[model samples]
Target: MATISSTWRVFLLIILSLCPITLSATVVEDLKNLHPPPHFNSTILSNCLKNPSLRYCSSSPMMDFDEIFKFTIVASHLCNESKNPTCVETFPNVDLKNRPNIAPLYLSFDFFWKYCPLSIMSIDLSNNSMKGGFPTDVLYCTQIQSLDLSINAFSGDLPIQSFSPLTNLTFLNLSYNFFSEIKLSDSQFFKRFNSSSFLHSGALLDEKKFTLKAVILLVGFPILVILVVVCWVWLCFQRPDFLPRKLQRTRRFTPAILKAATAGFSNNNLVGMSDVVHIYKGILRDGTEVKIEMYWDDIPRDSYRRFVEECKVLSRLHHKNLVRVLGWCRSRKFRAIITEWTEEENVEMWLSRSGPSWNHRLKVLKGVVECMRYLQEEWPEVNYELKTNTILLSDYMEPLISRFKVGDQTSNRKKIYRFGVFLLEMIQNKKGQEEFDRSYGEFIKYITTLDPADLHKMIDHRMEVTETNFHQVKQVLSLGFMCIDQSNNERPSLATIFNIIARAYKVSLVLPSTNHRIFHGERFKGHMPVQIK
Candidate 1:
């Protein structure tokens, strides 16, 4: 009787093992039968079933199929037809005849919306040759967090009403579309998006009917042009060298031109001033606004050399987060670096004004880290003068790292420590700012003693912290502490720091292997020690 029972138990286990396979096959069939069917081939269906997120799905064959059956069964259970429609009724029947090679997986959006709208968090249909007007039906998926419809032939005005219901939609991309007319100026719903969201789209500007303003411009434009030309001709004759020199060097602006642009370095034009340099807001003859960083005469010779080195670096360095170097002027009496002007406030000013959301703050942190990583990888010799004051915000609230001052020869670990201080200041809100005003040693001492439970006290009260993001916040604090460790060997490498932070935020970052070999003559070191994972 015992032997028979044991045999029966084994039989039951075998049946249970096959149950998932049976369920997956059934789900795949059901998915195939839905109206405007997913039309997935065995391979695509298998891939989709395994990873409903479609993260592992690729064009290549010889793919891993071990999880395919298992995932299909899970997806099938999640997409039970009894709860919702088998397919979204809104999506039209795909024209298989026109595009026979089209993958059934492409229609996964349909299945996702119909069966698991709540699970649908992001939709990226960018650069897919998608045509016709914006797919307003997508907005019906209320749980969607991000929507990318860029690089498509989508036309007509964006349905603003549809967005009103999408409270969870934080990211909306409509760039490189043929949208004809979209008036988002007054719409509170559309205010969340930046100008870049609607860039390279016809909807940027609607057809404007000629009005009294247009007529006034038409009548007064020629007179204005004539007066400008007359003044230019008078200036050219009176000060021939002045006008010629300005015209000849369009790329490089002279000190005299920069002086005039900044209203002869008027006090009103002064935007910022440091011990070594003064920053002035200026507008050139061509109506291009620029920031001029002028060095003080009292600046030491070493500081002057550092400025020149910085100019050389800035002229070559081109990153979205770094300020753009327009031109520079170096002479006996004058030394200045001109860059593209931005009217937006710095991180310090922005923080003072109620601060930003956790998401924006994280973005700023990420940008600063990326800039640091780039500098480390490209020019390990150069170090950034990173601080809240040095970091400016763009119109879209993107963080721009500025002020690349030459530093005394220091280990990369020390630079990382400084970055940690900066990051801590960013996270700690008002207290951090006050700490920043105090000595670095004091800030380090205070932070080291801070209890994990008291981290909330350090964070900005304006930003909400929930259980979902509590781990991420803590991770950042932990990273800051690790980075600011007194023992250089205890500190993590920039790559390791970046990886940890990226993983905490659920962002993917590929870093080069830290292990390397060095050979000198017959002697060779098999591997250099590196604290990076």
Candidate 2:
């Protein structure tokens, strides 16, 4: 009984293996019955004429002339019957290229593909707006040899595996769509067609390529911004002094505020005058004392331009010896430059009152020389109208030069010559008003002829001088003479002048011996002129 039971189990397993084959054959038979051999009961034209709503019928008219003519040709060959259409086995081609409105809303594509002729080999539906996934019903037309569906709005994964069954399909076009990927295998269909068949259909772009682009945009953008900021900070540290001047901020004052500060700009508030502007002492609302320079109202256009130029130069300056610009006030009536006010008197007034020692004078000279070098090399645009009257002495006797002349055309050589004249005035204990006006032509000529032994006649007697200081003073005078040379090329640069003064009374500077002449001659043979007050 056990052997019989085992044998029956073996027989059941063998029978189960043959069940699928039997069922497949039954399915094939049912399909053959569903779609029988094609036959024709009426012609292609008679069906289109009987149905007024059929394509190319007068009731369903088309606007495009080419499309209308094309439909007429198609209706004569391709039948519109529900079942067993005559053209199903006769017709082989359907050309619908450049038909934008080919697919109508009411038309049923499923019914059309269901009865599509197996003999139909080629179709051209390119350049249309028909949008959707790959047409599953199109597989029913198994005998298709060529197909064109390019330039449409089709999307989703292309079922390349499904097209693998259409072995006879030789030519195909599926370009210009929004498909995300190519589905299933990289079959012979893809091998027959290049990337142009799926242009912009997302089939060429792999997952890794897309991911790399996303990472570069998300991470690299911030890194680029950070690099730019780091470079700007590095530049700022490299040139701290230069950066501020390039981006200096200017302050603007209202006309009423300036007028009130200067007490209506009366003569009592006036401190000094220049060829273009009048200087006035003013107290601000914050109790800050400032010197205001108001341009004369006679030449409005010229004054406006000068005001702008001066403000540009002043805003950039940042040196101890140079004057600080406070702000500016402007209007149609007048324009003014507001600057920090110094308490001490100018060099001209200070010298006429008392005799300062050589050491004290040397200190002031060093300060002036440093400032001149700065202006010459660093900011030649200053163009100072340098004068003893414009140089002020502070409480500690440190020199503070005044604002630059707005439109002065003073050259570098002229500045060196002015310094020489200024040096002589300090030595003589007198102002050089005559020297400034006439360039001291007579004085230079007279001193050039005097003997070196007579140098004492030109010294300020009020100064308590010793033998050691006298030799140092002689060297300083020689350096000054070198600066005021008649030839522009012969004039010493501000740098050379600064070096001599910086080491004044410490290092002996050897200059031309011909420059050692003094002011003593027939005019001052007996005694010196009384010190000018």
Candidate 3:
């Protein structure tokens, strides 16, 4: 008897296994019997893509099929290759939440709601950006035990009458939406869920509460904003010391102190002029000589703002080659920047008096290169209209970068080109703007077109020029030519130029001529070969 019972159990297990195969065949046959319309696959695909209600619906069919059965060919193509979250599948739970890009796929099909598959026991469509009146289609889903439509943009009334049919819904979440009110046929339906489920939906609040909030937002917010702005402006103009300091290190000088230092704006004190400011010579009470740059009386409002911004940047910089910005003064009629005085003479004036020795000039060039490196790497936004007269010479003859704008829109490559022009001017002992037919472009053309053999003629005759020193000069000129190249691609980067200069001064680093093209074609008089160690 025990053997017979064991054999019966084994037979039952085999029957259970075969049952699914038989059931699958029947399910497929039943689906095929529906006799889907001609081009049914294409119709379903078109509906999936363009249907207004569920245009961005899931590829899976709206109606759930048996999980164990393979669907018929006609039904298989329904909503296939859909790129949206699955709204309906062969399971009981339907999750179509967090689909912000497009509308829910089930919305594109009326049948999905009207037919309301019995297998769907739960539906979540939260954070989907689905906006409208409460989803009335959910009423047909009689078996649905849970429904979440939170964090959607849904607005309008949540009619209690419409939701009454969802008697089986045990859990309902409708938070973070725009539902304006709940029109109740009875409050009994909502009693099943917590009041927190409808948070931020605007449905739970009474008329008085809503009105109070609306008034506070519409009327109070702007007044508060205005008060804040007024306070900020007052602090800026009337009580700057009360505000938090951004540039703590930078001193603010009074207009009287600046006037006293510059001898009440005397002609002798005025040393130079920029587009918007006058450069002056000044001496502080502590015997500290400073270059005072005062804004022109007719300077525009925007220019004054730019001047302030430039001072802020200049205060942060601390480099030997950079002229130290000492302080600034701003009042009703005066705005000025005070910088540490370097020397009475600039590069142009020093060159006008026959310039320094070759080695000394190289030292100056290296200092300038180092300054450019610091600016490019640390503060690329600070740009200047570089000119020989603006390039100051310190008491020790070190190049001191002065007179630059905070945000000059000139490209770095263009600045390099300008530097090349400055270099040529220094080499020839003549101002570029005054020479070569009084055109900057013509000056560049003349320098770039000069024959290699006659290059010595362009050198400063006052300087002691030997055969070895001449080669070093040629190497430096080659670099200048490279900087002045028309093609930005041909110009060596500042770092590369720095490396070449660093090596040129040291004889051990001077290398043989390589294939590195210094200039393109005959414009450079046969490639002005750049030799590096």
Candidate 4:
């Protein structure tokens, strides 16, 4: 009886030894069954076992395999080409191909919560034809440092709080998505990104604040209307022409009149064609030469309103160096602006004649600076497209700067930077054509290191630089360089620039007072005296 009992104990020990192998095979079979039957791949189960932290890889008994199966399938789909034995160890990097209909295949947050609680660092899914709302699964990746989901078709409102878990996230790109709005209690995290990240997406707002604003606007709209009516009546009584002009109902011109003036919009009368408008040299009924600009018929209503608004502003602006606007015409399919015509060619064409003399170039430069100063300080609008080609020379060789487009109201700093580029182009005798080819910052870096002796190399060869005018030329170059300084704050103001140039030229022009206000209907304090040759 004792021998039989000992044999029974040995048999029990052998059964226990084989139990582990049976359990491992069962776990592997369960993992294989979790995936779709026809689509299930045996390689996925093999990959999961390779993970060092997985229960199947360790000596311990198996735990729940449901989440592990899901994770293995998804990771295998993402990284099928990976050959490393320990590729699934951490699942740190994931860059899946942009396959069609990938949304349904993507695993949900539950899978990530169970399997990938930590260890992910970076995810790049840019330009990956991905669709659906923001994946809540991403929020589970607490240790993730970088996330790129740009150029996707993700739609619906963003779950703003989902990003709160990613405390370690430093770089994020959510551009080119279909998000409707962004609401976040933590604005400090959002301040890390720039406008580019949010551009091409839906409007961004704090939902709580936006709701409050909408309520207020709805409640106070009647009171706002009453206030506007009262102000309109007061302005009407104060000035008779104010209401009519403000409402933009003062003038109307028939399309026939314009067609007659331009000989039925003949090709022979076409003076210039640009992206926005076509310029025609027309003769008015009074035998006055005028330049007419007409917009295409397909322009949007908003663009037409902008054109009219620009005309109103241009009518009020008067400067010696600026082109004068005479009148404007609008019809169902036509919009036009009339300005006094000049006979001389643009600076671009004139420069082709062996370039202008040093004196003429300096004169042109002075005129351009004066015009820029007027636009910057006196005018309410800013000119961003100031270039050498835009400056037209009159019959008397006076510079007339034209071609103004209304844009987002910017500061004078942008104008100053453009003027610096213009000056550089003038000195180089090259059309501003090369401005975009090379990096301007690199050019500035090279120019700043050059000595005064070598500065003449930048001057136009056509212009003779003698000992007499060397200092003046160098001074202008230095001023231009200063305007193009890397730091906008370090650049001199327009007034200071004018003074420097005037002093260098030994001109007797009157300088504006330091405290003078140019915008309050005050005339320009300084005017360039016409040189009498």
Considering summed lDDT, which 10 consecutive residues are worst modelled in model 3? 67-76
Q: After superposition, how far is residue 106 of candidate 2 from its true place, in Å?
A: 86
Quality of model 1 by C-alpha lDDT = 0.63
lDDT of 4 by residue, 82-135 (tens): 222334333456554354444334434356334552344776667767778877
**Model 2 TM-score relative to the real fold:** 0.45
Better of 3 and 4 by lDDT: 3
Best by TM-score: 3
Worst ten in a row by lDDT for model 2: 34-43
Poorest stretch of ten by lDDT in candidate 1: 87-96
lDDT values, one for every candidate: 0.63, 0.62, 0.65, 0.61
Per-candidate TM-score against the hidden true structure: 0.45, 0.45, 0.46, 0.45
Backbone clashes per model, in order?
Answer: 1, 0, 6, 0
How would you encode candidate 2's per-residue C-alpha lDDT over 299-347 as one tens digit per residue? 5678567777778777677767877787776776667888888874888
- Between candidates 1 and 2, the one scoring higher on lDDT is 1
Compute the lDDT of residue 27 as modeled in candidate 2: 27
**lDDT of residue 204 for candidate 4:** 54
**Candidate 4: TM-score?**
0.45
